[model samples]
Target: MQRLLHSSAPLWASLDKAMLGKLRKKTGYTFSNCKKALEVCGNDIAKAEEWLHEQAKALGWAKANKLEGRATAQGLVGVASDSSCVAMVEVNCETDFVARNKTFRSLVERVAAACLNHGKTLPQDNLTKSFLSADQLKTVPCGKEGGPLADHVALAIGSVGENLSLRRCALLQAPPRSAVHLSGYTHPAENSLGVGPVLCGRYGALVAFKATLDSAPKTQILGRQLCQHIVGMCPERIGDPEKDSPNPDTDSESVLIFQEFLLDVNQTVGNVLEEHDASILDFVRFECGEAC
Candidate 1:
C-alpha cells in the first residue's frame, strides 16, 4: 500500500497543479499530496486537489497563506457595499496604460460588485464560478467573450499581454440585527492611476472599516483620516511618535502603523481615537511595490 501510494503521487500532483492553478495559485505539501492521492483514484487532479484540501483542512493545514509580495504594476482597487456587507478587491494589470483604460476599470468595478453580492453565499472555494454575462452572448471589445470573472481576467491578460492578478480582498459582515456603517478611502491618484501608475508614486495606503450603529461616527472618520494620514505622512506604524525614529523591531514604514501616524507631526491618531466611542475591529492597508 505504501509503494502504491508513493508510485501514484507524482502523476496526481501534476494533475492537481494543472487543475487547481486554474482556480487560484496553490502551494505547500498539501497541494502536492493532493495530486498524488488523485492519481490513485484515476488521474483526476481536480478531484484529488479537492479531496486533498478536505483532508488537509481536517488535519488543520488548509489555512491560506497571506501573499505579501509586491503586486504587479497594473491594477485597480474597487469597493462595493450594501447595508450589511462591504467588499474590497485589488485587480492587477501589466501596464499603467491598460490599468487606466475605461473598459478595464468598468470590468473591475463590476467584478468587485459581484464579489460583494455573491461572495459570502457562494461556495467558498468556487467564488468566481458564476458567469458575468451569461445570457447576452456578447464579446468584450478587448477580444474576450463574456464569462466568469476569472475567465474574463485571464482573457484580459492574454489580450493585453500583461501579467494580471487579483491580489487581495476583504469582506465585512455585520450582525443580523445591527445596522452597519461602511467606509472606504482610496488615494485619488491610486484610483486614477490604477495599480501601475501608483506603483511609481512614493507610497500610498488604502484602509477600510465596518462598524455598527452604536459605533461612533468619529471611528469612521478616523479610519478615513488614518488612510489620508498614511498617504501624506507615510508612517511605519500608528504608535511610532516620529517617522525617523530607529527601532530594531520594525523597518518598513508602510507596515508599521504607529510609526506612520507619528510622521504627521501636526496630528496624531491616538488623539483622534480618544474622541470616538467605537472600536476598530479590523483594518487592511496596501502599498504598491514595497518590499515584501
Candidate 2:
C-alpha cells in the first residue's frame, strides 16, 4: 500500500519529502490501506486523506489503533476583504518554519481573498466557489486552471517540502452602504526566536464597525485606536473585568476601556472614547493557539 501510494518516484524525487515520510511512518494500517486510499482519491493526496479519515471513522480504526495522540502545530493565518465583506483564516502546517515562510503566508492571503469573493463559509466545499465574485458569481472548476485557493495550498505543500493544511476560516458581511475594516499585527522579527516561537507569539485582532458618511470621524478614530491598543496591550477580553481581573473597578487592569492605552499609556481607551459618541458593533481577537 505504501509503495503504491508513493509509486510516482521521479515525480516526487526531492529532499524533505515530509508528506510521504509521515505516511510511511504511520503504523497500525497495512500498506494496502494506504494504496486503497490513494486509488480511491484518484492519486490526489488530500482527497485520499479525507477518504482515509472516513474509513478510520467507519471502521473504528483510529480508536482501535490508538493513533489520536498525533499533534498538528504548524500553519498560517490570513485576513481578506472584498467590497462587501471581510474574512479571516488559519491554515495549519506540519512545521512552524513552513508556517512562517513567505510562500505559505502568500497562500493564506490568497485563500482569505477567495473566501471574501465567494461568500463561502469556513471549511468550505467546492473549491470553485472561491472564484466567483459578487458581480460574476458562477460555478467553476476545482484546480489551478480555475484558481481555486485550496488547490493552491495543496500544490504549494507538494512543492514546498512541508505538510500544509487549511484548518479554519471565518467571513464577516456588512449590509449595503456599510464598510468593514480589518487590522493586523505581527511580532518583530528580532523578537521571533524561530518559527515555533514566532508562530506561538503572533497575535491578531479584527473589528467590524458599520458606519456611513454621516458617521462621526471621532467614532472611526476611536475604533482604530482601540484596535491599535489591543495590538500593543494584549487585552484578554472586550469588557469583562472578572476574566482578566487584578485591578477591578477604576484601578482594575481588566477593564477594556479603562486600561491604559498601549500606544500612549497616558490616556485610557475610555478617555479617548469620551470624545466620540460612536457605538461598537462587534470585535474579534485571535491568538495562535486559541480556538479556531
Candidate 3:
C-alpha cells in the first residue's frame, strides 16, 4: 500500500509527505485513508481533504446503519435558551465513556443550538411547543457553515466509532412581548464547550411561566428554581396543581406543581409560584437515555 501510494504521487513524494501530514491534521482521518486520498487526488491537499470527508461520511453512515439496532441507553441531555425560546435535545450512545468525550459533548451542544435556531423560525404568538424526530432533525442544517446535521453526526460517529443517536429534540417558545418568563436548567451541568449557549448533563428541563407582579430579577430567580425543581422532581405533566386533590395512594410528585420544591422543601412548587404571583405556562423535562 505504501509503495503504491508513493508510486501514484512519485513527483510529489517530498511534497506528499508534507501534504499527508497536513491532510491528517485537517481531516482527522486514519493514516491509510488520508494517504489514499492524497494518492487518489495526486497530492492535492484541498481535494484530498474533501475526499476524506466524503469517504468518512460514507463510512459513518455504513457504521450507523450496521449499529442501528444496538441499544443506546447512555448519553447526554443538552439545553440552550434565549430570552423567549429554549430547546432541549437528548443524544444517546452505547456507553458513558463516549458520552463524556469532548467530541460527543460538542455534538450534543451543536444539536441543541440547531434546535434553538430552528425554533426561532416558528411563530411565537403564545406558548408553543415543537418536537423533531431523529429523522427530521438530521435533515436540518447545522454548524457554522450550515451542513446537514446528519453529516455532522455521521462524521462524529466516524471518529467516535459508536452508534450515536439523536433520540429526540423539543423546543419551547414564548411570545417575545408577552409577560412569559423562560428558564432552563441542566442537571449536573457541564460547560464542556466553555463558551456556547448550550449546557449539557444527565438531565435537563425548560419551563415557561407568567408572573403578574414579581420583579423581573425575582422572576428570573423563580424561573430557574422551577426548572431545577422540574429536573429533580421528574414531573410527568404540569397538572393543575391548585385543583387536583392529593390522594395518599398515588404519587403527586409526578405532577409539577404538587411536588415539594427542591429549593425549599417547606413549600410545594405550587405554593412558591403562588407566593411569586406566577403561574406555570408549560414545562419540558428530559433524562438522558430515558425510555421513549
Candidate 4:
C-alpha cells in the first residue's frame, strides 16, 4: 500500500496540455515559464499565476539591471498635451528598430502622460515649467491605479530584450486664467499605435504664448509655426531683440526671436509674433539621446 501511494503521487502532480494552455492564456507568459511555475506551485493554478507575476517582475528587474550600462543613442521623443498643459519625455533604446516598436511607443506615450498629469497638479499659473530627471521620473505613478513608472519600464526592457532608459522629462502649463495658448509639434510626427493623442518622433517642441487681443485663430497658427521653427532651427535661448541687436555673423539662430521664420523666411520670428500680436511665454525643445 505504501508503494502504490508513492507511485500515484507522480500522476497527481503531472500538468497536462490543458492546464499548461490555461496558465499561458491567463498570464500571457511563455509556455515553458507557465509549466515551470505550475511545477513549482504543485499544480495549483492560483499559486502558479501569482508565481508567474513574481517571476516576471524579478526577471524584468534582473534584465533591466544587467543592461543598464549599455549606451543608448537611438530612441523616440513622445509628447502629450491638452489645453492647459503639455509634456515631453525622452526614452532611449539601443536601436531604431526598438524605438519604432509599438510597445516602446506606448511606453513613451504613457510616460509623457504621466509627466503632464504631474504638472497639472501644480499651481496652474502662467508658464509653469518643470523638469524631471530619470531618477525622479521613476518614482512617479504612471496611472490612476498603476504601479511606479520604473516597474513599467523594467517590464518593457525585459519584453524588448534590450536596455531601455527614461532619460528626461519636461512639462509646461498655462491655465485658462493665464490666457496662455500652448502648441506642441513633433518632427516626423507619427501617431502611436494603440495609443491616443500622443505623438512620437525623433524631435519635439512645445510653445506657450499669449496674444494682446482675443485672436485665437492667428495665435494658433503662429504658435504651431513657432514649434516647427524650434524643432528645425534648434534655438538655444529666447533672446530679446529690443535689448540686443541681431548680429548676422554670430550664432543668430541660437536666439528664438532673432531666427528667421521656418515657414516664411522673409520675416524673423519676432516680426511674425508682432504681426499676430502674440508674445511667447516659454518654450521647450527635445532631441532624442541628446546630452543628459
Estimate TM-scores for all models. 0.48, 0.53, 0.85, 0.83
Error of 2 at 231 (Å): 3.3
TM-score of 1: 0.48
On residues 143-248, what C-alpha lDDT tens digit does candidate 4 reach at each position?
A: 7637888988887887888999989988888876667888888898887665557888999999888777566676666777889999999988888876866767
Candidate 2 has a TM-score of: 0.53
Candidate lDDT scores, in order, read 0.47, 0.49, 0.81, 0.82
Of models 1 and 4, which has the larger TM-score?
A: 4
Off by over 4 Å in 3: 1-26, 30-45, 212-217, 247-252
> In candidate 3, residue 140 scores what lDDT?
75
- Score candidate 1 by lDDT: 0.47
> Predicted candidate 3: what Cα RMSD to the true structure?
3.5
Provide the lDDT at 174 for model 1: 49
Worst 10 residues of 3 by lDDT: 1-10
lDDT of 3 by residue, 207-233 (tens): 889897536788778888888988887
User: Which candidate ranks first by lDDT, i.e. highest?
Assistant: 4
Write one digit per residue (lDDT tens) for candidate 2, span 1-292. Answer: 1122334433333323455445436523445555556555556667766676455433333232232234547665455544345555566666778777776666655565555555534343211112233222213122233544544554555444555555554455555444443333333212223221122224544555433435556444555566666656666555633354445454446556668877777877655555443334455554554553
